[model samples]
Target: MAGGLVAGYVLGKLYLLLANRLRDHTVSIVMQFVATFLVWILGEQLGLSPIITVVVYALTIARVLPLRGEAWLRVQRYAVWDVVILVLNVLAFVLIGLQLRLSLPQLEGPNGRI
Candidate 1:
């Protein structure tokens, strides 16, 4: 856990540095997604808690970018993320509901006798 946190912090800083140095908007935007994916997967591969690692990494980016006062960079992150997440969440719940429907027979047997 501690190791995960440390690695996440360091990786996040480097990622942010590279992100900050990027002059192209398209590349910067793509890098955000790639960096997140890599951080989580890399953390897991290294036998660390990917959840903790990603959280710390995200927080580092979130907190530092604002302090750096790069309006364009910080604002672009939210441009499509919220809507995309919302749509994905809705789809996930729909799938979950369908799976639950399939398991209804096992959940209730002979008038609610589990």
Candidate 2:
């Protein structure tokens, strides 16, 4: 997780630099994928859940300081698409969980039995 976070931060910074120079969203997304791959690899090495590690790393990158005005404007322009993607991602998670029977444990009484 720590390694993922570090890699994510580095990747985000690198993306910002590249975006500034190239003015390309494709490069930014590619950098994000590279960061995610790094997180997955590091998580596997550390015996952690890769998906969870990558999600945490991605969220850390998202919440970093130094927001850009142009990025904000772009986000505003694509807010609807963002919402759609978020909903689709959530639905995918739900479906995967259901398929895997990975629901929360049923609440149990004082007996500690479900």
Instruction: Return the top candidate by TM-score.
Output: 1
Candidate 1 structure, TM-score to reference: 0.86
**Candidate 1 residue runs with Cα over 4 Å from true position:** 112-114
Looking at model 1, report the run of 10 residues with the lowest lDDT sum.
65-74
Candidate 1 residues 1-114, lDDT tens each?
998899899998998789768877678878888999999999999999999999999988888766764678667767757877999999999999999889877888777876
Q: Please, what is the TM-score per model?
A: 0.86, 0.44
Backbone clashes (count) for model 1: 0
- Alpha-carbon lDDT of model 1: 0.86
Write down the lDDT that model 2 would get: 0.61
Clashes of each: 0, 0
- Evaluated at residue 104, the lDDT of candidate 2 is 41
